[model samples]
Target chain A: MSIRYAILGFLSANPLSGYDLKKLFEESSVFHWSGNNNQVYRTLVELHNEGLVTQEVQQQADYPARKIYTITEKGLAELRQWVLSEPELPQIKSSFLVQLAWADQLEADALDDLLRKYDAEIHDQLIVVQEHKRRSKTSPQRTPREAYLWEAIMDNKILYYETELNWVRTVRETLNEMGKDK
Target chain B: MSIRYAILGFLSANPLSGYDLKKLFEESSVFHWSGNNNQVYRTLVELHNEGLVTQEVQQQADYPARKIYTITEKGLAELRQWVLSEPELPQIKSSFLVQLAWADQLEADALDDLLRKYDAEIHDQLIVVQEHKRRSKTSPQRTPREAYLWEAIMDNKILYYETELNWVRTVRETLNEMGKDK
Candidate 1:
């Protein structure tokens, strides 16, 4: 549902082929669509059907024909409507937390191991988010305001990861304290 | 998929009817399953079919029969496997962020309105998380370690909300700064 709007959002800026959009999404790792590449093509086809986007085939001499997508005025209006709609509080549905809730059944050592593993993963994610922030700075087409909003988005991801890492360590300490009490 | 494991985790603690499971899930709001009540019933059926749970129907004089589900040995084994599985870094997916990415097209005042709306929604969610934390503490069944884990889950939700609120304000200020620059 959101991928459609995001595609339209991307097209609102400039016309892009599926390949170009895919590349944009890759660079957009932090808040990219949940689905893979096929979802992009599939959404483009659906948008074409809905008249939200127009596609033109660009024939290349050496490469196969490429389909370029541009958002129509209708698509822009739709995207605008979405922006003005009520913001649903984004739910943090963490399965790791679920595991923590019921993982009392696991031995303390095993549970601590899980927390350690999660902390390690968060560490790696922070590195990737740094890369995202770096790459995002290179997009010169965005206006100064857009650039600021984009940085805010990156900060959100970084804040989330940092909080998770802190929580993991806190839990680990709690687990150790419990073990010591035993 | 995570919900299935969560149900098994609940059953591992005690046998429960579908209705009872639903109530537990409601109280477990900090990390509750994404699906509605029907998904609980559907998952229970699937678990029974898979021989991971056994269903016993109890007939009452004044009420209809209720199905009680008990996790089988297989279910316990499956839940353990899930707990031991490598943790997946939970992707932070916010369609709000996606909107922020493209919403530079909107008037500055309009974008700030969206951010303010988001801030208000997060405020409301923090209230609910507090209520959930209060309700969670009343459960006498959890061991000390389990209780600690539950509190950590609450902390996780609180931290997320706080971070999001902070980010929203930061973005609003950034918008203001950009407006000044213009």
Candidate 2:
């Protein structure tokens, strides 16, 4: 459902084909569609079927026709409703957390190995997001508020990753203390 | 599959019925099963069929028979492997971020209202997690390392929430500055 709303949000910005939508999501620092690439196409189909979005097929000389999607009046209304609706609190479902909940059985060395690997992955992710932030520029066409909201999304992601990296450091220090006490 | 491991992790501590497992998940600050649930029971069934867990039906007078599940040697091995395995990086998929991407259309008052409501939820959730941390107790039977790992898990959650709450504050301030600029 959230994906549906996101698609509508994108269409509201500009008329885009599924291919263009895929490109937008790929370059997005905020929302990356996970799993199959077809989710975008699937969601677009649903939106079109519901009459929230209209499709206009553009014929090409040397390529297959592309269906361009535009947000309808109903789509814009639905997106507006979703924007002001109370959002769901981000759920706590980190598998790593679930692992730590029972990792008392893991040998100290093994546990440290796991934490180090996890930390490295997070560190790499942080760098990727930082690079994305460095490349982001507000289009002159966007209002100041829209640009700020975009930056806010990026900041939310970056801050959480930074906190995770720092927590990993603390956990490792705790591990070292436990080793010394033994 | 991760929930399957979590259930196995719990069973490794002690045998538990499906009912007991549900209670454990509900009380868990580390992992909360979302949606219609029954995930625990479904996972237990899968584990039992896979020979990773064994169940004993305990019949009682004035009560329905309850099936108690214990992690088999296979389940224990699987859990240990998962503990040492590399963890997947957390995905960035906040619906609020998606909403914000298109929320430039929102009236200034409506946007502020949405931000305030979201902030309150994050604030309340942080308090709930902090209270859970305050009430947590380490069992005497747990080794020092085990206890610290438990604390690390709690610290991980608390720190992330703190970061999120702080991010929300900064976002609201950004909104206010935009208002001033206008």
Candidate 3:
């Protein structure tokens, strides 16, 4: 799956312990993809079983020994193959949309309240995304190419939220019009 | 989950046999939500266990006996509760974005090819969505309110694909520019 390839891609960049991968995944933009500690460890085990990654335990002076993972040559090859392969269609399951689909079941006033609440939620999200974009833009650590791709991802996220906000406003306006007519 | 409520929503509209539910699910816009027969049946059993639904065997003259499911009062209450509750945040796991995140690993040509292929795929999907919209508009069985909600869902789908198509084109252009400067 894409998670496996995401792991391989991270490993391809540099060697990382399971704990390190978990931290990086959580702290980075990759958090949007949402991999948890258990998933990270389980995926590492699977990748090791597949001979795509190797693990070595490093003993520390005072801390507990930790296992470090490195991508093998096969891992790199597989990662490249995955990058160039056909991307899987995104699986979208929007609970908001589901509610909207059945919105007619609710009274006009109740539906108006629902849309207003959802609109506020999306507005908060848009602020977060915009802040992330601002931070990413100023970060000197990113290579020009990396920055370009990162911006692309951020732009995608921004556009998505904006589109949703626009839809919410339009739906709210239409609902208001319907109410007035009645 | 949402699927349970989706089933309840449909049953709230009308009593349906298991086979009827399966057919309706597959043939309707609800297919975007992605439920299978096994899941439908399993959820039905769960709903029955919860006293949210009841089933009766209806004998057909030409066909085998079928179990028809009807939403109980509890089921209707649950469905309305779900419709009014805070919607879950949409979980997005886009393989294309995953690929883009690691795209620097691939050669420029390979990345270019990937974008082109993705663009073509989105174009094909837009055609399908547009066709569905046209058919839904002409369906006379929908009430004015139902038609409005359905149109909102269709508009959401159309906007999403359009946004994706635009992103694909922009990314491809940026990649092309990156290639020329190199």
Candidate 4:
């Protein structure tokens, strides 16, 4: 699915400006997605032309007038149709796999540094997931199901990061034995 | 990193034909990577032209004589430099997440099925992790550090999958209350 669909889906729930959609995406599902700001604005224009969403211009004194988009009935129908359809398998292109693939040709020290950096990244993400979980526990708007689902997703993320950190430590230890520090 | 490096890295280990390289990738660290035959063959030709790899035609009885490639010293140096360099952050673009981001648009039943499928996939992966852990226990060629690292990776996979499965179940239960069935 394209980011266009995501924008439309968000608008389906309530009217939102392009800026609002961007903010919602980052706050709600930042871990699973990333989008170029240009791409989001571009998709919004295309979605408007396609008649899936309509824009209302609101005047503001302190800022520029904003275009707020709401999903049309046709758009809601399309979203439902898209959901019933089977999704294509996502392409997995991971840099970690590439680095490891060529590890045999790499210097011992280089491999150690890569592992160390990777370890740090996982640790940082673990912290983010933990903080997200703690915050969700107190949010009043969250239904019981949404609360539980959010916690499960964050917990899974924490466990995954912890696993990566543990794995990197082991890789670093192996590099030390091979004389990486030297 | 590009698939070009992955192919070159494998040749740096030992001279191997396209078929052999494919098999090695499947069994090696590159197993986590997905490379089609066209990409592998194209990368091999590019490497040969760039003088990063040397190819030789070898005669075989049952199959056609294949061109095997071995990495040149220059290729090894390049791979080494890459390993020492900072790794790019891992970026993912998942259609599954895109679908979930617009989940409000889905029919309750459709959304329920999606959750169920995701849950099943995570469960299946957890089984694979457990099997890997079991195999690592019996392998003697594996160093102590290697065993620990591999196990840590496996444990993380298990945990992540379980966490995802739990999220799916919670989503499904919520959808069920909305009259969605799996």
Tens-digit lDDT string for candidate 4 (B12-80): 656888887666555432245444677778888888888888989999999899998888998887777
Runs in model 4 deviating more than 4 A are A23-33, A57-65, A84-93, A104-112, A132-144, A147-151, A170-182, B19-33, B59-65, B92-94, B101-112, B126-163, B166-182
- What is the C-alpha lDDT profile of model 1 across B1-182, one tens digit per residue? 45899888888988889988787777665545544679899999999999999999989899988999999999999999998888887755677887777787789888889999999999888888888787775243468777777788888888888888888988889788878877
When only chain A is evaluated, what TM-score does every model earn?
0.90, 0.91, 0.87, 0.78
Tell me how candidate 2 scores on lDDT. Answer: 0.80
Q: What is candidate 3's lDDT per residue for A1-182, written digit by digit as tens?
A: 54788788778778889888777666555345555888899999999999999999999999999999999999999988888888666666677877777677789999989989889988898888788888873222346787788788888888888988899899889879978987
Per-model DockQ against the true two-chain complex: 0.69, 0.72, 0.67, 0.30
The clash number for model 3 is 0
Q: Give a tens-digit lDDT track for model 1, residues A108-143.
A: 789889999999999999888888787774243468
Give the residue spans of candidate 1 off by over 4 A: A137-141, B137-140
Write out the backbone clash pairs for model 3.
none
lDDT of 2 by residue, A120-166 (tens): 99899889888887777422227878877887887887898899999
Local distance difference test, per candidate?
0.82, 0.80, 0.80, 0.64
Ranking by TM-score: 2, 1, 3, 4
Candidate 2, residues B42-145, lDDT tens digits: the string is 88899999999999999999999999998999999988888877788765457877777788998888888888888888889888878877877422126777
Question: Per-residue error at B171 for model 1, in Å?
Answer: 1.5
Per model, the share of native interface contacts recovered reads 0.63, 0.71, 0.64, 0.35
Clashing pairs in 2: none
Interface RMSD of each: 1.5, 1.5, 1.6, 4.1
Docking class of 4: acceptable
Model 4 scores a C-alpha lDDT of 0.64
